[model samples]
Target: MASEDLKEDQEVSFCLNLFTLRCGHSFCRVCINQVLNTKEGSGVYSCPECRAEFKEWPSLQRNVTLCNAMENFISNNPQQEEITGISCTYCVHSPIPAIISCLLCESSLHNNHLRVHSEEAKHVLTDPSSSIENRKCSIHKELLMYYCTEDAACLCMSCTLAEEHWGHQVEILDEAIERKKEKLSDVLRKLYMQRQKTEERVQRLEECRGRAHQKANREAERLNALFTDIRNQLDDLEKRMHCEISRQEEQESLSISDLIQKLELKKDELSRNIRSIEDLCNMPDPLTILQEPDMGDLCDPEEGEGEEVTGYVDDPEQEEADEDSKGDTGGDYGFQQILHTLSNIISDVNVVFYGQRPADILLDVNTAANNILISDDLKTATRTDKKQNRPETAESFQCFQVMSKERFTSGRHYWDVEIAESGICWVGVCYPSIDRRGWQSYIGSTNKSWSLFIGRGYRNQCSVSHNKSELMLPYQIFSAGVRIYVDYEAGQLSFYELCDPIRHLYTFTTTFTEPLHAAFCVWNKYVKV
Candidate 1:
């Protein structure tokens, strides 16, 4: 009866393959199939435990819940115990689980047994494991106590005294483990700090990118607003010109209309005067003609006004030419106005800012390279054939280079340098920390400096270089020399050729971390700033 009850309980338990009947009862597929096969010919069958009736033809649906639960249960339970692992030897009678093992006794103990276990320095307690044989030296059959530093392995006392490890450095196994743990902890701390620093650098880079995007957006917005205003102003200027021409046209038309009205009245008066004269000449009665008013009345006192009207009507071409003459004058006037306003607008857009630009930039003698001669006023650097007797200093340059006395750390600054008309030279900016020897010290060859190199030939090919990368600038004529401008905080360096209208030569951009000084490299010529 007990076995039958247990089997019934197994029908609804979690298993690998399970299926549910129409009545919501679950059972393993194997057991359900085995029981249904017994009633194969019967068309219907009854559930084993619930006794629920079901058609033999009913489709079986796999129970997914039971499959998943079965997977988890099997993975975590019924694990085969390791035969070599230590168990509760002291708990042999009770057979309780072992929690700790004693190396001195080679036995595992439970909590109650450990309360009465021997308390000795040699009794090393640890997690219950089958390490009795592993803990001892296979050759000596003795428990390994000391650690051999030379061989990086555990050693038994007998092995430590033997010929193999005779004079090698050794420490207690417990002490060695502790020391290793301490070093590991220290290394872990350093790794954590390194990770923190990396995170901070990443965040800083992201912020820089955000700020750059904002700056670009602001510049675009400003330009857009400015252009829109310019367009509106241009539109207003055009409207004002049209209005002026319209006013001129209106005034000329009104004047011509008034003259035409006067001409019509004068024509009627001239016609009446002629008709009266013809009547007086046709009359035969001299007395009747004499009876008319005095000669002043017959002649008409307003005849002079009519003569003026007749003069304007006789010169039709002249009248037409006179009309709207002021309209042409107004057009000329608007043209001058348009030209003047455009010139002013252009000046405002490209307004030259000469603020804080040093007029006289002096050279530093200490940083001058070999054979470089500085003028007494320190404004000029000349490359001489004869080397001057100067003491070698840390700040001195090894090549044909020189630096300015003035160092720029912040704000915008620009200085003009007059280069030799025909010679190879370099004009750029460099940090004070530039290398003092080898090719790296040459201007434009290292990351610490930026330079523009002008060639010796007629074309005077110019190239800008930084960190060993060079970009050749399109050849252009230079009349005066070159101008160097630097915005330290903005990390912008620009070189402009002092030609007509001051053409921009090149520009370099970077994040400057140190103060910068103007750098110059010249040979076979002199440069003045």
Candidate 2:
């Protein structure tokens, strides 16, 4: 009866793969499968645990709740009792569960035994280690109280007075421990501060990375916007070119058609005359031939008739001849115009998007002509009727011209000239070694100079490579400034008429053999830069 009660209290093992039947009985899946197989021939099934009757077979469902409970119970009751019993090694009356073990005696003790051993032996006790024996000096058999620095050993007070360790530098153990602890604390503090500095550096770098990412995104957006404009301009230009070509084709086709119609009419008239002449020639009598009404009016064409046919015959060739006109003529004319327009647009875009631009260009009085009067700040120059008293130098221009103190040998540069109080001022770039004393030394008059002139409300550009090109300014106001861009390496000098939307005046292409100086000609009053 006692074994039965114990067995009833013990936990019964249950397979995790359990299934529930309609009769409320739980069993492993294997047992349920065997029962279903055994009752298959009879066409009937029942729960093995309950022995309940069922006519039709019903599908079983897994007992998920019971399976989860079993898993948790098994995990909570994991088997871990390796040493089932611990008995006192010192007690002889009966084996007792140990509470503490003594390494000096190499024995386990119960609470009662441990109390008696501690009262009689008075041995130092710990949970497991024999630290008491280790603390006692091997030779002195006493607790260590001082440390000998000279011998690098721990010693009792008696050992310090021994002959072998006499006169050694000694320190109390407690004092040494305190000093070491303070040093260790200082080291830990320094390490903590270093860690903080490293953390701060990392945070700073992360912030810098974030800002850099933002700036890169902004720059990418700007580039995208710029490319969008470029694409639109290209599309518009393409459409215009196509339209112009189509217009020319239509006009040529119409003219050719009209000439073909006229020629067909003339050919029909000639064929009729030939037929009438053939009929007269078919006459048997010579008198009939002579009497056939005025054959001159029939066979012979009227005067000036050849000229009309010749004109009609030339119309087809006229279209081809028109296509082969002078430089940049016909279809090529539109192409050249578009190329120049796109180049101008791209140049303006570069000026707006690119690097450092020309700023305040201070004019050099020493390089100015004698007839030129420079302002106090050396940014304004005025032409005088009489020459002013000034020191003569080879750098000074003898003509009505003044140059900037800044000289450019390479790289691109841009500067604006505010043409005020003068309708006819010349703004351009020229070689520093250009003839400055002769009548032909005027800007745009020599090979070493290129200039843009605005006078009488007219804008004109002059270069040594091509003849003067007359351009219409967006605005008629001459007081508005003009921007000059010089690309030294590319050997290009471009002039722009500055207005709300800047317009390109002209561009000069030439190889620069020497450094160029920014030259200004104040023909009448004054010009500010």
Q: Find the candidate with the highest lDDT and give its number.
A: 1
For every model in order, what is the number of clashing pairs? 0, 0
Model 2: lDDT of residue 327: 40
Which has the greatest TM-score?
Answer: 2
Instruction: Count steric clashes of candidate 2.
Output: 0
Local accuracy of candidate 1 as per-residue lDDT tens digits, 1-529? 8545644554554445567777788777667768876765675788887888865334456666766666555555433234234468876766766777887787888788899998987787877766666777889877779999999999987888888888899999989999999999899889857865664565466457646645665556655655565677789998998898788667766766777788787789878978988898789999988897664564566655533332133467766665457356533337777876675444333323323545357899999986899999998898887888788889898868899888888987888887777767888988899998889998899999999887653577889999999998886545557778776776778777665344556667689998888889986587889
What C-alpha lDDT, on a 0 to 100 scale, does residue 42 get in candidate 2? 80
Which residue pairs in candidate 2 have backbone atoms (N, alpha carbon, C) closer than 3 angstroms, thus clashing? none
What are the per-residue Cα lDDT tens digits for candidate 2 across 398-510? 87898888888998888888776435678887788777777556777677777776663335322222223334445344446888888899888888766544555667778
lDDT of each: 0.74, 0.70
TM-score of 1: 0.34
Candidate 2 residue 275 C-alpha distance from true site, Å:
2.3
RMSD (Å) of each candidate, 1 decimal: 25.4, 20.9
